[model samples]
Target: MTKTHEGYFFEDYRVGQVVRHAVPRTVGAGERALYHALYPARHALYSSDSFAQACGLSAAPLDDLIAFHTVFGKTVPDISLNARANLGYAEGRWLAPVWPGDTLTASSEVIGLKQNSNAQTGVVWVRTTGRNQRDEAVLSYVRWVMVRKRNPEAAAPEPVVPELSDAVDPRDLVVPAGLDFGSYDFDLAGEPHRLGDYAVGETIDHVDGVTVEEAEHMMATRLWQNTAKVHFDATQREDGRRLIYGGHVISMARALSFNGLANAQMIVGLNGGAHASPCFAGDTIRAWSEVLDRAETGAPGVGAIRLRLVATKERGGGLRGADGKYLPHVLLDLDYWALMPI
Candidate 1:
């Protein structure tokens, strides 16, 4: 009998199956410190306890993406350990604020599956929910990954692609309890741009760049407890370099957007995202954003702005080439909804 525990392959997944991932994590100030160290995140609401209190929160919540990365990392072993790629994301929403003393656990339900034309790999879709110590869902999203089939000759299962929402309806966006930007301080927040200041289709170049470092990327990945081979093992790919975790790019880019979007405080929804190209250490990542749409929220003085954030290696590289495939320099393309003061 084998004493090893190999992760699930594509064929192992069945629609409607639920999996509670192991290793619940208790997050505290330490994780918060490293997060600030890893990215240039400086959103005022997340930076100051007083600011958060004034905005009706008890204190500053953990960086939204920290909650996101920590929860997403928990699903790696069960979901993407055997993955060829982290394909994309959709219909994600932050259900609550994660406090410092909170413990987070992750679980996933297999909602859809499809064996690809090439028997060697198949796509697995899962709706994942992250819960805090109190058993309240903190975050939820759907992600699909391409996982390799142990045996190429395995019989294909009938595809069960779940019908997902094109975007999270604004009415469904959850504002943290007591959150009120009605008295928000524009000076403290660093940027005076509010929801009305941004026009739909308006593009803003974030005007900053950070060259990713090997030590830093690994430290961030380990801090999140992600053990994906492609992220840590250079031998996993034909190239002799470890692939930078896609979430790293997401956080780095989100942090960079702060210069122009400082008031875009809390991330409440993730409409779609893609790791269009593989990112490796030593790449200098730059970001840009386009305001896609805007809507009024029920929260007092709050509004929702849907944004398309793009991260690239080359300064002027576009997301898609004429052929409709992602340009080589395009690293990530993310569409999300954020809370801004009206």
Candidate 2:
């Protein structure tokens, strides 16, 4: 039977529980084109069949975050169905690059649980994993959420919180084997920036906008198999408009940041993020980025760049204000990492 409700409560979870989320996905060329048009991403390995072939791949692989969202979205039904808040995410690592036409699926296992002293709420932690049709592990991460207890009179469960790392170690970052950018085309990659050019604290304002549409959001959410009613059923929303998937804004902003941060590769961490405001159809989204931090990894020929990307809807003709507060036109506040050429 299909379980309805997201934002699961504290009383509903137990340690050792495994929730297998439904709906698998098959990636294709359309998604590849969208990745290019959406972000200005021209990584030779992802953009050219010839370049990819030289490196021994059939074609460019899907962006890493695409694999992440596909995996994360599956756990929503069982894990977040009744959540009060998404506490945090840690230990996110991309294990393998996913090629187009590959089918993927995901599942989550509850690792810990804690009941609040108030007896009305508690916390649930889960480790989620994604795999391809071949059953190769593609991505994994840990997340926790605040959930309400159905019965306030019930005794609180013993608290158990798993220790997590502050940041994923650079040594742990996995590079796709046989990835030889030696034959990379600077022109076709869409920019002249290379691994050596970006500074640790530089920011870029990706100057483009895309007017969102209901059909577009629906198609995207359904494509990820994300069935949140608010994102799809207009009637379920108070404003009588479908809520754009937060991931859509994330993708748009990440893609736009490529203009100046083209060499930033492979998101290795998802420290935190927020959908500051609801994005609706017809809202034109634009993006800007701030370099939060940078670290030299032990990996040869690679560095890690952390960025904060903000997506906003243009108010008439110009970008919105900068009080660090999202205007009604704002859509997302994202913080993450990317691997860059050294």
Candidate 3:
């Protein structure tokens, strides 16, 4: 028997299958330090214990993306090891705050599959949930990836594309327990623009940029323990360049948004997102956001803001071209909801 693990292919997946991913991670202050070093993340709720306590959290919780990336990393070996691309995401929600010393485990349920016309690859959809040591779900999301077929001639499974929501309803957004923004410090939080200050249809260019570096991107991927082949194996692509991980772009864009949206803290819901274009090292990434809507949350003095965050290679580029296809300069299109002061 060969001791090597070759990983799963598109044909290996079936609807209704459940996969418990390996390598649970215990995240602590170290992950937070590294995350701040890797990205320009400076949200006060995540950056300061005193600030978070004032806002009613037990303490400064790990950055939401820290929880996200750690959990998503655990699924890569089983979900996207042989993937050609990670397509998109939808209906994601952060269920609970991930405190320091929390151990996270992940599992995925295969829900949808569709073979490609070329028969060389197929798309597989999975709903993944991340839980803490107490078995409380910390995060949940649906993602699809295009995986290569080990045997192109294999018989195709019946296509079962899931009917996913276009966006997460604001009422369903989870507010961390004890989360009160009544005492939120606008000065320490870095911006005074409260939820009421933002109008629907308004756009804000973050007005900053970061040049993606090969080493930093790889380090971030390794930190998350994401073992996707295309992100690490140069030979995986004919172009001979390691593709920057999509989550890396997401963190960078979210960090950059701080300049203008500093108080839009605690991401609670991810409505939808796309890796609109492949990003590589040396690309200068810029971010912009549009306020899509606002809603009152039941949390004390807290409100929810819906945002369309766009990341682009160029400083200010249009999202779609005339044909409604993503422009080449666009790198990511993320729709999400965050908690802010009323």
What stretches of model 1 exceed 4 Å from their correct place? none
**How well does model 1 score by local distance difference test?**
0.94
Tell me model 2's lDDT, rounded to 2 decimals.
0.73
Writing each residue's lDDT as its tens digit, candidate 3 over 1-342 gives: 999878899999999999999998999999999999999999999999999999898899999999999999999999999998999999999999999999999999999999999999999999999999999999999999999999999999999999999999999999999999988789889888999999999999999999999999999999999999889899989999999999999999999999999989989999999999999999999999999999999999999999999999987657998999999999999999999999
Per-residue lDDT tens digits of candidate 1, residues 122-229? 999999999999999999999999999988988998999889898899889999999999999999999888899999989999999999999999999999999899
- Candidate 1, position 79, lDDT: 94
lDDT tens digits, residues 90-186, model 2? 7788888888888888988899899877787788989999999999998888888777787788777677788877767666767676655555456
**What's the CA error at residue 71 for candidate 2, in Å?**
1.4
Better of 2 and 3 by TM-score: 3
TM-score of 2: 0.81
TM-score of 1: 0.99
Clashes (N, CA, C under 3 Å) per candidate: 0, 14, 0
Candidate 2: C-alpha RMSD after superposition: 4.1
Angstrom error of the Cα, residue 99, model 1: value is 0.1
Question: lDDT of all the models against the reference?
Answer: 0.94, 0.73, 0.95
Using TM-score, rank the candidates from best to worst. 3, 1, 2
Candidate 3 wrongly placed segments (more than 4 Å): none
